[model samples]
Every structure is written in structure tokens, then in C-alpha cells.
Target: MRRDELLDAAEGLLCDQGSAALTLAAVADRAGVSKGGLLYHYGSKEALIKGMVERLIEDFDELVAAQPGETYTERYVGATMAAVRSGRLRRWAVVTSASGNLFLLAPLREAMTRWHREGLSEEPDPLASQIARLACEGLWDVASHDPGLNSEDDLQALEARLRALLASTA
Candidate 1:
């Protein structure tokens, strides 16, 4: 299997067991590869973490690019909402914890900033986007950490409402 497949498996393991369960030996075992084989692909734990971050960023970039051509506000809202709805944010939290590297988020933050600056053609409403983004992020964080925050129906309704807000603003 490819390195990404290994990382994906590792991320799943992280979700299942948290940081305590994400040793390289564990990843290799889960991936059905020997420790030496895993080491061959990733010389060290740091290298493996870095590769996971790179893979995550690359996948995020692709997701952003896959959206239909629309206004900056629309695109951003759609992308962000897709992230929330798909439960990717929760999965990402698992990956983040396993990697134990905050720097991994830098590329994502930079990409978002660039998308905001270049995509919004009108009078840039930085505050609005920031608020919306934060709200969505809050929803994801809460959903990931607190299962009682919203029922499935409640979350779907909230997502619809958020999408409407984004559409109207866009």
C-alpha cells in the first residue's frame, strides 16, 4: 500500500484510540507492514507525521478546487460546509492529535486566507467570513467533542440554515 493509505489507517487508529495508540509500530501493525518496511517508507516518526500533514493539505486543496465556480463567499461557504457535513473536521482532529504537530495546520490556514483574499470580488467582508468560519468550526469542534450538542436532525437543519446564510451573503 501507499504511504497515504498507511497514514489513513493510522488516522483511523487515532480516531479509535487517540494519541496513545498511534505509535509507528502500531501503525505498521495496522497497515499489515513490518516495522522495517514502514521505516523504509518513513525514516522516522517525524517524517511520517510530516507526510501525513502534506497528504492532508493536498487532499484539502483538491476538495477546495472541486467546488463549482461561484463567488468567493459562496465557494468558501460551500467548502467549509462540506467539510463540516462530511465529518472531516472530526477526522482531522484525530489526525492532528496523532501527529502532535500544530504546524500542520499552517498550510490550511494560509490556503484559506488566500482563497478569501483572491476569491471575494466585492468589498471584502472579512468580519463576516471570519464569523461564519468560526461558527462552522465551532460546530465541528463541538460535534467532535460533545456528542450531545445536537441530534442528527438538529445538525442537518443547522447546516441548511448555515448554507442559506452563506448563499444570501454571497
Candidate 2:
């Protein structure tokens, strides 16, 4: 709980202020914890950013788990749509941009790689499924910055289209 609180503070700092302002002292102050207390949870800025990345992954996983879908592609689409609707993906874009550290993005990359593998395994038409996944992911990234594209109706339509593609391939 304390860890999450600290991470919450870090995320708030990242969102409210740019990465340049995300100092340990700033997070400690923002979290209402002593610097030592913050240190106890996260030793460095890198660790805190890493924690934020992990939290994002967990958030996405929860969305995926809650989605009712028969295949990984379906679940992925559902989760991405949820992320866009909830503005979580937009916040993630801010977090990733603020960090400016490729090393920190490794965990995100690894999770995506794993998800791609799982998505491929569940679909008989791997090419279609892969295309759907890529397209969905592309939309997810783009929607974070484009409100018109992220609207509920638009996202629903996009999901339907992706599902249709998958269905056609199957």
C-alpha cells in the first residue's frame, strides 16, 4: 500500500510536472512522506519510473482480465479500448514521454512481446490476428493523443472492425 502510494505520488509528479521536475525530494514531499520513507519504497528515480511502468502493466492486465472474450485478440482489443476510454493510455503516454529512458521501457516492451506471443497462439489465423493486434495497438497509441479518435463510438466501431477482420480470417 505504501509502495503504491509512493508510486501514485511519482505518477502525479510526472503528470503534473515534466520529468525534469520528478525529483526524489519532490515525490517525497508530494506523497507526504519523509525522503527516507520514500527511499525505503523506491531507492532511485529509475526505480520509481519502473514502478510506474509496472503499475501500468498491472492496470492493463486488470482490464484484460475483466473483459469477456474468447480469444487473446478479443481481450486485447477490449483492454485497449478500455484503456483509451479511461484515459489510462494517455496517461501512460505522458509517463513514457517524461521518462526519456529507453531502459525503463524494456518492461513495457517485454510485456508487449509476451502479449503478442499469447495473441498469436490463440488465433488459428495468425496473420489476421497479428494484423489486428498491431492495428489495435496502433490505434491505442494514437488515440491517446487524439480525442476525436478516442471517443466511445469511434472506439467501439474500431473494435467491431477489428473483430470483423478476425472473424473473416477465421
Candidate 3:
């Protein structure tokens, strides 16, 4: 869809140039759409961000839907592992870091609040599940943004350890 294309272009811009460089003109140029078209789809950066958040929720939902596990906790672990491997969430770094001062981020905050509530509802051991999620998320973020932070062997070992931790909890 044109909307998805525009959001993808905007995300690419944020990843490559940081949020400071994201402008309507840049997004239009990157998306190969006219500025008017861009405006027609998303009136402002805030709306675009909301779109991205919605896209994220959809992507995660797809992962859950495709999960092989019958229980929510098992599926959560599977989806979390898949997300780390699939590279589907790296631009979230940009979203968090986007325009420290200018962007209101209220919608983003609300969306995530609701997602957290709904997404993790069935986990019995919240602390353990949260620990696993945090560890996987931290590793994925670091691996995506700064590969130099850990050698490939180190990363493999850390992943093995994380898996063990998850298995123990599960």
C-alpha cells in the first residue's frame, strides 16, 4: 500500500540519518511520492509515528498468530526469539530516540502502554518473562546498532545463555 511505502521510507530515513534529519520533503523524496501525497497520507511526524507504532503492533500480532505454541507464554517466547532473529524491530531505536525535544510522543507512549498490558497478560511469572524479554531486547538492540560491542562468538555465547535462562523459566 502507498501508506506502508511512505512509512517504510520514513523509517529508512530515520535509521540512516537519525530523527533530526527527517523532514516531509525528505520522506517524500525517499518514498518517491510528491510532498502533497505524503501530506495526504500523514499530515505530520506524529501521525507517521503513530502509523509506525500501529505497524509494529501488527507485526508482533502476526508473529503471535504464526506461533506454534498453544499457550500465550510459550508463544511470547517464540515471538520474542523470532523478533530478535528477523530484524523486524531495529528502527524502534530511532522511534525512542526521535527528536528528544520536539516530538510529543504521547501517542507512542499510549500505544506502548496498551501493548504492554495486552501483550504480556497471560504470563504467570512476570519478573522472569520480563527478564527474558529485557535480555533479548538488549542483545538485539546492541547487535543491530553496534556489532563491535561483541564478537560473533561472544554473541553466540550470550544467546546460548539467554536461551538457557528462558528454558529454565519456562
Candidate 4:
């Protein structure tokens, strides 16, 4: 619970105040923990960022696991849509964290590679699954930068189209 609170504090800083404000002292202050406590969990800024990435991936994985779908592709698409709708902080972290440190991306890269591999493994048509997966990721990128670009209806339509495309190939 304390760990999660620290992570939440860190993300709050990242999302609300930008990456510059995400210092260990700031996170410790925001989390109402001592700097020592923060360090006990995350020894450095890089470690904290890596923890944040791991948490984000865990959160997304849980969402994907909980989703109801006939196939991994469907669950993945649903999870991607759900994430795009509610993952502004995550998107921001992914977009902004890399600039601070390239090493921060190693975990993200590994996770994405694994997800891409697993997301298409069960599909009848790997090409269609790949396209849908890429489209979903692209949609996430666009929505992260400009949420206003797609209305609720637009998102629903896009999901439906992607689902249809997946179903067609299935």
C-alpha cells in the first residue's frame, strides 16, 4: 500500500506537474513519506521510473486479463481501448519519461515486444491481428496526445470496426 501510494504520488507529479517536478524529494513529500522511505522502495530516479513503468504494465495486464473476449486479440483490443480512454497518465509517462533517460525504455520495449508476440499468437490470421494491434496502439498514441480529437462515438465506432475486422478474419 505504501509502495502504491509512492507510485501514485510520483505519477501525480508526472501527470500534473510534468517530469521536471518528479524529484525524489518531491515524490516523498507528495506521498507524505520521508525521503528515506522513498529510497527504501526506489533508490533513485531511474529506479522510480522503472517501477512506474512496471506498475503501468501490471495495470494494463490486469485490465486485459479481466476483459471478456473470445480470443487474445479481442481481449487485447478491448484492453487497449479501455486503456486509451482512461490512461492519460500512463500515456504521458511513456511519452515523457524516455526523454529523461533512454534506459527507462528498456522495460517498456521488452513488455511491448512480449505483448505483441502474445497478442497475436492465438489469432487465426496473424496479419489481421497484427494490423488490429498496430491500429489499436496507434489510436492510443493519437489519443494520448489529443484526447479531444476523438469523441466517445468516434471511439466506439473505431472499436467496432476493429472488432469487425478481427472477426472477419477469425
TM-score each candidate.
0.77, 0.92, 0.73, 0.92
| lDDT computed for candidate 1 | 0.69
Q: Which residue pairs collide in model 2, if any?
A: none
lDDT of 2 by residue, 1-78 (tens): 999899888878877887888899999999999999998988898888888898888888888889987788888888
The candidate that wins on lDDT is 2
Better-scoring candidate (lDDT), 2 or 4: 2
Please report how far candidate 2 places residue 64 from its true position, in Å: 1.4
12-126 per-residue lDDT for model 4 (tens digits) = 8777778778789999999999999999999998888888887778887898898888888888889988887786536454434634676887777887887788947668899
| lDDT of candidate 3 over 1-170, digit per residue (tens) | 99999989988998889888888899999999999999999998777777776676677778867877544545555676676566665766776676464445565567446544554656656566566666655765675676456665665676567556656765
Q: Taking the candidates one at a time, how many backbone clashes does each contain?
A: 0, 0, 0, 0
- How far residue 8's Cα lies from its native spot in candidate 3, in Å, is 0.9
lDDT computed for candidate 3: 0.70
Question: Which portions of model 2 show Cα errors greater than 4 Å?
Answer: none
Looking at model 3, report the run of 10 residues with the lowest lDDT sum. 111-120
Write one digit per residue (lDDT tens) for candidate 1, span 42-83: 887777777776676676667667766455554555666567
